[model samples]
Target: MEILKRPMGDYQTNCYIVKIDDKEIIIDPGMGATEWVMANVKNPIAILNTHGHFDHVWSNSELQSQLNIPLYSPKGDIVLMQSSTWMPELPPSTPDIAVDGDKTLDISGIEVKFHHFPGHCPGCSMIEIGDAIFSGDFLFEGSIGRWDFPYSNAESMRESLQKFAKWTIDKPLYPGHGNPTSVRAEQRNVDYWLRIV
Candidate 1:
């Protein structure tokens, strides 16, 4: 398994391309990755979006059209995805597959598990492929996603954090922004941040 991160857009969102041999899966194809992914990543099987934030899904339509592959996002963030206030210039493109609940997807033999976490947005989630997790805005190096958006809920973030606390604390976490960090590191940070937030 090969995991590559390409930070893109004004926000410097982390766009990941996970490849296993010739099969590839893109997670969060943000702005500025359309040209790069079109040239480099080959025969992508699908796109797994962690959430519907504009910065995260900026290149969804471009990649989906060029690669002719399906894009999937958690069903809960449909509202945010469609709102121009949140999505900016990128008009909402309905995902081919809307992942509503916890399930495992078999993409040409590679297995990806989707777990809804809902905090940063209404339909926030984390994608688990192999031993790596595409956490989107959920867990960052020493911080969590912003829960101050109009659609974002502090209570939901708290609930998600509670569930996150029980998850295994050893996997690699690829966030939507910033450098990747381990679950153990974020777990400790979550403990400290939760007390103040």
Candidate 2:
């Protein structure tokens, strides 16, 4: 498996392209991501979003049209995707598949899992592919996603942290912002986030 990451937009949101064998999966095609993704992918199979935040999914419709691939988004953020919650200029993108909480599917023979961890947004989740987990805005390097934004809930974040505490399987975590970390690495900090958040 090959993973390529490039930060996009003013927010510097991380957009990832995960390649396994001949097929590639695009994760979180944020603002100004279309050009980079177009250059990087060959056999693009599907577009996956961990959550539906303006900065995280700004280039969704553009890429979907260009690549002509299926889009899989968490069910909870459908509203956020279809409507401009944060940025009014946000281009509305619709998902071909709406992933309910913590569901896994076979995307062209590859196991793709969506681990629902709502806190930053209603449909906030982490996309798990192979040994890597694309944590959209859930778990960062040392800090967790803020629950201060609209549609964000502090209680949900706390619950998600509690749920994460029990996650025994550790994998490399690629967050929406900043550098990468591991599930185990962030797990150790979950307690701190739980206390403060």
Alpha-carbon local distance difference test for all models: 0.84, 0.93
Which 10 residues in a row give candidate 2 its minimum summed lDDT? 78-87
| Tens digits of lDDT, candidate 1, 1-197 | 99888899789999888999798899988888887777768678998899988888888887878789998988887666665674567756679998996879988898899988877888888899988988899888888988998778888888888888888648998899998888888877766757755
Cand. 1 Cα-lDDT: 0.84
Question: Model 1: runs farther than 4 Å from truth?
Answer: none
Candidate 1: residue 110 lDDT (0-100): 88
Cα-lDDT of candidate 2? 0.93
State how far residue 30 of model 2 sits from its true place (Å): 0.7
Candidate 1's TM-score: 0.94
